[model samples]
Target: MPPYKEGRERMKRKHSVWMMILVALMAVSLIGCGTTQSNLENKDTAKPAGKITIGFSVSTLNNPFFVTLKDGADKAAKAAGADLVVVDAGDNTAKQISDIEDLIQKKVSVLLINPTDSAAVVSAVESANKANIPVITVDRASNGGKVVSHIASDNVKGGSMAADYILKTLGDKGNIVELQGIAGTSAARDRGQGFHNVVDGKAGVKVVASQPADFDRAKGLKVMENILQGNKNIQAVFAHNDEMALGALSAIQAAGKNNILVVGFDATDDAVKAVKDGKMAATVAQKPDLIGKTALETALKVAKGEKVAASIPVELQLITK
Candidate 1:
């Protein structure tokens, strides 16, 4: 009797051990499954599964023109069901170059750049080219690089329009001042060329003084103040951008000067209001918003390996009071 009871006790103990082992194994398996599910959920929620991202490197956000451009790009990107990442270079060429590198590393589908300086941005553009990322330049162009496309207004024509307005207002016989944009930019170079083409050989319309205002309002004001100290008989002023034109107008007003015709480009909202108020004689309107939208559209096409124009020109208009 004692031997049979002992055998029964041994069997019960073995059964208990087997049940405990099975429970432990199941617990581990459940935990592993939960971990996997959590990881998948986290990954799915963090980002869209197949959304394409576009990188936009802006020269400066301080300018209203660039802000408008960014707005247009953002709207277009949203409408196209694409993601956008924007970085402002703050008018620093080196920063812009670094920003482009960062975007390249992110593996963006496309890059939209508004260069701070044309020649200086070539290296950045080339980096994108080497990485096989399509780049579409907006507003300003790189002097050297294989860009898919460039979107901007006909700045040369705009400058000539300003010159014509100045000559018509001043009778083509008055001394003038020119406030230029940032050096090494296509906008400034082309605009300056067009202005000079009209005024360089014109009779009695001398360029008494010309200076680089760096497309900045503060710099324009300071430069105009200095120019006024030397040139007292200036009859008209042409600025490559509206910011500089407004700054020049401020200087003219502060110096108690009046009736000096001032012309500007970009036709920013403030500049348009100034023209309507008679503070500025006229401004060439380059639809910055439209240019930005066109840039994004072209970038999307390029990312899809589609053909796009090498140069896309936006229309320009002259606004006068």
Candidate 2:
């Protein structure tokens, strides 16, 4: 072979080796990118932190008892570093259901309900159950659905206490009138039953007139007015709650019906004052504020997936002048 041909062949071989080295480097770079990308894809993704919010559906704020209850719940929620949303139903069952639905939509951590009517609020409770939100009853209870817990006083016993006091003060024989609460609430039913159990027919002590005042002071006054017209010989009046009791007291005062001892439930501020002023015979003291506070605390525990008791009871007492 010629010397020029041999030198050209050696240069050609050198160029091929350099090209192979470049291709290998390119392949390694591509592999490095793929491995980096795979590592990123497999890594756990971080998510935004979420805040816990609670929703409360109150029966009516017009009444002092429920108002105090709401205040307690509000204070509790604020201390826990959680948001509290409260809705008022104005003692309207339909509105309460709507309020619960809205709360569900808001994705509240817990749903609290002060039902206007026990039976009517079932579907609302069921709706919360469907959403997997825990429900805790305040002041009043629901007739149906799965509730996380119920916190209330023994209404029946409270009712019995009222009746016993009335009868004892009346000397166990007098014409008594019973002022009922909202018709379908557990408080109404239990309280009425308790009164009846004690004074149904004991020593001729009788309930001369029994009517529902819907737990409103204005309605209570009107109902008492109507009852006063027909039952001239009535000696005492028993109202289911302080609102109704206070109403009846107004009517009794307005009618100039003297010596007719008036008693009420729920020792609301007004009722207690009435008793102190020597107008009302008594009012049942249901610590609504404590009930409200306990409810919020239980809800927080539930939010933490902690187990809680099925029922919680608050203290009940009778206040009299």
Candidate 3:
């Protein structure tokens, strides 16, 4: 072959090799870009950071009061753009403790508890405390634990008013059957103390029977029925809550007794209506909806590391026909 032809062929081969190298570099760059794009999309779709979540543990929703309370909390959470997790303990303390633990594992930003039994719920509160979640108790309080805030009505004052009304109606001297709430709860204890503080001092007045109905309407009915069997001269009834009061009212009606004055606390819708209808003598009004809404708002503030009042007392009043 000629020398010129051989030189030209070598130059052509060198050009092909350079072109192949450039093509390989371009392919690797395209693959790297695709991998980075996929990773970014996965990160975006994953759980969002810094989203506020609240947990509410209720004693029970069997009664209308707690149902109304939960409704208020739901509305407040929706308004504040926070996620809420509500657990019902069915008026059982052990169940409540477990529910709280599950909520803590979920990493909630705050916890709101309406304890079934005050003394039994302390360990649940402590666990949440260890998880670094602030706790706000509503309606009922824990006997022991660290709580950021407590929101409820002044039960002692309300109880006093109920007792005074009974005293005036019964002429300060009569046999009264007291229907109490769940034992060991703050509401039951405080309300009972306030009532006895007034009634116990009256020499002519006598407490014929005192029993716990667990703040349940059916239990109240049965207990009152049994009390009526043993005491025929009972002049009045004072229940710690409206559910029990309403239950006691049922017993009174069933026994064909109309003159017995019945008073109750927590003026729920049904209780208010009964008061209006002359079925109940009186009831202390408690704004459960306000309590629920306020609790959630306070929890949000607490999650932001803001200081809140130790006790936030809602207003109370007596409702009568």
Using TM-score as the measure, the top candidate is 1
- In candidate 3, stretches whose alpha carbon ends up further than 4 angstroms from where it belongs are 1-50
Best by lDDT: 1
Cα error of candidate 1 at position 141, Å: 0.2
Candidate 1 achieves a global lDDT of 0.94
Winner on TM-score (1 vs 2): 1
lDDT at 7 for candidate 1? 100
Q: In model 1, how large is the Cα lDDT of residue 226? A: 99
Ranking by lDDT: 1, 3, 2
The deviation in Å at residue 182 for candidate 1 is 0.9
How good is model 3 by TM-score?
0.87
TM-score of each: 0.91, 0.84, 0.87
Clashing pairs in 1: none
lDDT of 1 by residue, 14-106 (tens): 999999999999999999999999999999877676678999999999999999999999999999999989999999999999999999999
lDDT of 2: 0.91
Error of 3 at 160 (Å): 0.7
- For each candidate in turn, give its C-alpha RMSD to the true structure in angstroms: 2.6, 7.6, 4.3
lDDT of 2 by residue, 1-321 (tens): 899999999999999999999999999999999999888876745323555678999999999999999999999988987778999999989999999999999889999889999999999999999999999887789999999999898899999999999888988999999999999999999999999999976877878899999999999999999998998999999999999988899999999986999988889999999999999999989988888899898888888889989998888998987
Candidate 1, residue 11: lDDT: 97
lDDT of each: 0.94, 0.91, 0.92
Residue pairs with clashing backbones, model 3: none
